[model samples]
Target: MSDYSIRLYVDSDYEVTRNLFRNGIIEHHNKAFHHALQRPHIWLPALVVLTLPALNLVSVTTSILVVLTAVAAIWFYCRYMYTSYVDYALSDDMLDISKYYLQRDGFCFWVAETRGGEVVGTIAALPSSDPGGEKHLELKRLSVATKHRGKGIAKVLCRTLIDFARRRGCEAVVLSTSLAQINATKMYEKLGFRQTHSFYPPGLLGQFLDFKIIAYRYDIPAL
Candidate 1:
């Protein structure tokens, strides 16, 4: 977009980028909450609570309270899930972008900035962690500010990573997205990425709640 430009991240961009990362990930909690509500394990009990009023097994007031409680629980669970991820990320590579990405060969982080120099988006690429996988780059932390979206910022950021991977002799680029990020998943598909696999997030809570994360790979074509 004419209003924005892409450039490598710097120490001065830390606060804005950190806030962007935190807010972007946490914003999906509502979507996850609604998604969870649609699951049988989550909603069935709420459904039973709703039917209690009609079946005369519980007063209407009591049934409403039960349903409300279930909804609140689902919301809290979704909130916890997203916040936990944000916490882990903030403490990981994000905790020191320069040391983890800038200083490493075949690894870098970039930000999309407004003409006025505000950091509105971020993306990073690093060598894949899988043992013996030198030909793959892992894309991470792709986020564009809400108001600045829909102007091709995300697509350009992704293209930047792909180009970087190509230059690094990487055969493909890989990334992971949560099920809550439906729009992102669709965009990746449209960009020619294929679903490599899907898995629930780590931890007993993630497994018990059945939250899913999808992995995608984009093979670089020969120049």
Candidate 2:
């Protein structure tokens, strides 16, 4: 892998990470049209996990009625924040991470094609309910650009992130998706991710579950 090197963004990788954050997020919203604009992101996984399920399951219909209201509530009460927590684990020195980043499209799309070169695949991380008692990662998005699909690129990316997270002390990495991207779910399964949970987007569980963590633990040396 001498020719291929994975760049870690932290405070040092701030600028680029920020760019990755901004461009990627905006692109995501434009296309998917989902997320808490104020803070649709899950900054506190455990709190969300606990409070949400504990929230009365409600009449199944009541749950339906609660959807837009919850969306409106979150839109006003939350704000989106980007992170390269893995990057922070990569270095001991304080990093200026806002610069030297990539966020052109969505991160899944961006990293899949950085430097205007061929990008085979992509993975997006988000928050998940912490039933396992640790902050988790959800695959917010995963895509293997059409030209590069069917190759092992997506696996490579996921394996790389798994290794990165292991070294960084992350208990797990997670993500959630719907019919819109069934292939992504399949890829995650190939990589050993079992669905701890699933739901219709904009559903109650959607708010409760943030990151979709895979079941298997991957350990590989980081480059």
Candidate 3:
């Protein structure tokens, strides 16, 4: 809806980004992140880059080198974020989303929304109902402070996820959402993550249904 800037996650941003990620997955939605959050190798380099904090005492020059190295590694990561965007932006497939939010000086992020264009925007559009709702892509997790909802950051993040997923080789995208996040539901529909008449419990649904939240499948096909 509005304008926003995107960047990679630097080593200095490890904890902030990680927490944002964890929260997005664990807090708002408890669904598996694109099959599994850790399954994607996209986040490992950033984790490896962050291990340098313990070696900070090795030397000032070494520390600076590590920081710079981490920044470059992070820049390379920025490329993935962009690719993921491309994958979902132009496809009829699922999406992978990873991102950060601005904190006092850094960022905190943890919400990924995926949609497939093949599906309709609401349950009425679906051909029929199911025992557990229609199936869809298990996008990634996402979270934002209640104080920051109406600002439309989530909308930007949803679009970012679609673009990112498209870049990652997806034709469209899908997700399992819930009513606990009514505002987010509206955002998803607004962005084309239509409901498809699916029913998602209002609790986190892990790979094996690990949490207590309901979820609905939202899909976004190629544009």
Candidate 4:
């Protein structure tokens, strides 16, 4: 794989970075759905419900309704999440690009580009939201184009964040990611980030997502 250059985000990179993030999410969602179809955990529940009618435990009409309800719930939940994510991103730094991230204190955004100047990835380091968390930095919006996987673009972005945090006197760099991002989880682990916490979306959404959200942190040594 050819090396990609990493640098601070520029005004011209706004659209491409947004596209990379959006497309990365869509790609992950598609891959997750395909994986779910093959997983026994997902299929087994549906299978049990379908077999109930044959066993006379549920009437045919009720069985059909049950199966359809389950399918609909999953579909609607995925759609809700997708819409919520896009809205959240659009309403924040991702939309304004400059005000929230560029002008904000202790927040830095970066873009990775090929030698030909095609932007392929992006990442950010932002100040922690916790009131007393001055030493902590939050890693946010890390993404690379689907076709660019296995090319070390993600590693470069991650390392850039780590180095940036170290230079900024950050005690640690943390991020929250979902289980659907298996490759990202692995990459973080390889980069020496430890699993520090797990979180859920809350209420019905949490139930649907099965509490897949997790947190990872990397401790930075003082120079």
Compared with the true structure, what per-residue lDDT tens digits does model 2 show for residues 46-137? 23544554577445455544555665544432222112322342242123222212332112212344444433344544334457735454
- Residues 1-223, model 3: lDDT tens digits: 2233433333443444334433333333322323223333434544555565676635555656775675555444333333443344323211111221222221122232123211111010111123442332234434543444566666666566555554544444555554334566777777766565444333332222221233444344546
Q: Residue 94 CA error for candidate 4 (Å)?
A: 0.6
Best by TM-score: 1
User: TM-score of each candidate?
Assistant: 0.94, 0.42, 0.39, 0.86
* Predicted structure with the largest lDDT when compared to the true one: 1
Query: lDDT: which is higher, 1 or 3?
Result: 1
TM-score of 2: 0.42
lDDT of 4: 0.81
Worst 10 residues of 4 by lDDT: 27-36
Cα-based lDDT for every prediction = 0.91, 0.43, 0.40, 0.81
How far residue 223's Cα lies from its native spot in candidate 2, in Å, is 19
Model 2 sits at a Cα RMSD from the real structure of 12.9
Between the candidate structures 1 and 2, which one is better when assessed by TM-score?
1
Please rank every candidate by TM-score, starting with the best.
1, 4, 2, 3
